[model samples]
Target: MDPLPFLLQPPVFYPIIPYACTIFGGLRPGRMILIQGSAGISATRFQIDFQCGCSTRPRSDIAFHFNPRFSSSDAHVICNTLRKDHWLDELKFSGAPLKKGETFVLLFLFLPDKVKVSIGGHHFLDFTYRLPLKDVDAVGLYGDVTIKELSFLSSNPLKSGSADLQKTPLSKTFPMGLSECQVIAVRGLVTANPDELTLQLKSSDSIPFKLTANFQDQTLSYNSFISQSWGQPQNVQTPFFLFYPERFFEILLLPEAGLFKLAINGTPVNDYRPLVFDLKSIEELQITGSAGLFVVQC
Candidate 1:
């Protein structure tokens, strides 16, 4: 194979200041290029070392040469050498383990003097240099890694609200209880139907309070609302309030009549930005039983 090209004279300087950062240039797996010998940039020995010229090195620099074919096990990693002649004595930095077919997310947080690297929610490293790190600078990556999104978060980040939100279904059933009157709020579609819903409310007692609404007359009608005590079911359209531990239950409403806002259990959501669809239209509605069994798996 032909020898890799080299710069004639490499300077010695650091490209980053104490807190500045450069976001990765498109170095994701899709646009990854195998690196060999002194990745084009002149090596700076200190902060003030200017780029002398394109220079080649025999030992102090890293080679980006890849095998003729792709191999996950043989990819290059980021390394730091003490001297230009001691490549074998280099120190390698490993980020999170790169698994084949696994997609990764990279975030660069630039502070006044340092840069923080976050990979898949796991913090990788903080880079501090003697000079300013320019944008679109090349970092390091290897095999079996796919980049999903490369983002630069300023003081005000630009991202969807759902990016950091996660929801997990309740695994255990909750006992019967009443909700505080202050909790009910109306937003999306709410209706009266027992056949299409199963709710488990818990109070101070160990037994979960069970209530199911059956839609008989094409509308879901229920006079009973959850409270702290084993109270009497009253005839009311809105939720009545009482002190309770917390309300824990799952409801599956029809596609047309969406999720009932649990904020207060009554009038429609009005405080903040509303979602386009309160309840997603799914084929099945599922809930776990008290014993952790699939109680209502639709």
Candidate 2:
């Protein structure tokens, strides 16, 4: 039930058929692709492909091929791979939910070992990797479909190396303290029916930034604790409820000039000015909540 990452990339709206685009940063675990479109009224078939490249003469290898075919008698979904212009063993599933002239939301969540496919907010199937996921660099859509929007959501903010994957109620200290350019990225899944999730940047005697996700109220609030007491809380109602129960989320905190910028998923959510001025004094990061932590990178 993780919410789809929206507005991460410049959405491709109403693109011409047979669309193909390079996936920036390539495919990785925890990344998701969301597509919103409708099938053509007279359409017989359509396909979504994750390809190694965009080559056509030799036909670039397809890591995952998700095709839905609508026949007079049978309507099913076929998943397979294409390598060296040859099709691999096909895996077919019955009862494809897609219908002609109906708008649908398609989500592909990339995990470590398999790709989870969801259509119209419902779980469909999991496609195991026949080809390595690291090789997928592009995505394509072909045949009778009209795409309203296509978006890519990245859970990790670190670009060069692996991040520390850990559990929640985590408390880590930094001897060198924080810097102006530091970015702390936290990715996790909220527990079912979570009450509250808190993330704090703390110093020896003060907390410069503390972010709280109030599930019951569906609000994101922030405040600072400098004089042994909390400041007036600033809350923002997230209409989309980014941190729903049992939903995956990614939060990024970047230290700017005089404020800290917070982004959920890939969208910038808020900027909070801190009561404490010294960035170096912020030596600890603490997270306590009802969520499973995946990646924590500073």
Candidate 3:
């Protein structure tokens, strides 16, 4: 929520073409690689490689090879692995979102089993690893692309070694209580047939705010529990549904100026003014739902 920390390495700006650099901490789940650049007007193809090492004569292994090919009629992306100078089966994704001469922001989100790719802040495609992810130690970018910036974002702070969000009903306590300008981020994956998901900010004797995302009814509502009674529930009027089965999601709640601002997947949703006046009275955060959580950052 707070401008993702660059824990691995400092960002590189305006690097020369055919650049290759060591990945300080290697690849890990929850880490993200962000690239901002544009293709040349006559660009045909460019490749981004996650390699074991930078070897020339012997050619080090490539764990993931992401190649985007541009053409006059159609565009496509090819994903594969290179082991011992031999490429594995290539996976082709048609209708690539990339275009020659167009600037774009690319994001690669590393997960346990697959890598999620986003182009220009929109989900594009996924590439599963053929080689072990832990072996990837360097990254290489080649061909007719001008890179503006490149960075590696830190993984979830709450994550432990080989530990993911499998336990439910997760809760976190704030010793000094919450204050204004603080943000809470919750990221997870919706179950295939999720019914409902609830996130709450609780005080000693009451719930200052509770959000319920009902997938069954396709609605999002919020309320407060105070004085042994539940307040009137209010529905959030969103332009479109934000949650989907088998999809990843991020929820950000920021308390500011006597109200809470909410956002879903980088898009602002709505603000809600709570019944509780004392923001510092909120001491706990709780999440319970049918989704599989990846991280909860306060």
Candidate number achieving the greatest lDDT relative to the actual structure: 3
Worst 10 residues of 3 by lDDT: 153-162
TM-score each candidate.
Answer: 0.24, 0.65, 0.54
- For model 1, how does the per-residue alpha-carbon lDDT over 21-98 read when each residue is reduced to its tens digit? 222331212121111111212211111011111233442122221111113342222423223434333333443433
81-114: candidate 3 lDDT, tens digit per residue: 9999999999999898888999878888988888
**Candidate 3: which stretches are off by over 4 Å?**
1-3, 6-162
Candidate 3's TM-score: 0.54
Candidate models: Cα lDDT each: 0.26, 0.81, 0.82
Model 2 segments more than 4 A misplaced: 1-21, 27-46, 53-63, 70-75, 80-135, 141-165, 236-239
- List, residue by residue over 50-72, the lDDT tens digit for candidate 2: 99999999899999999999887
Q: Return the TM-score for candidate 2, rounded to 2 decimals.
A: 0.65
Question: Alpha carbon lDDT of residue 64, candidate 2?
Answer: 98
**Shift in Å, residue 146, candidate 2:** 11
Of models 1 and 2, which has the larger lDDT? 2
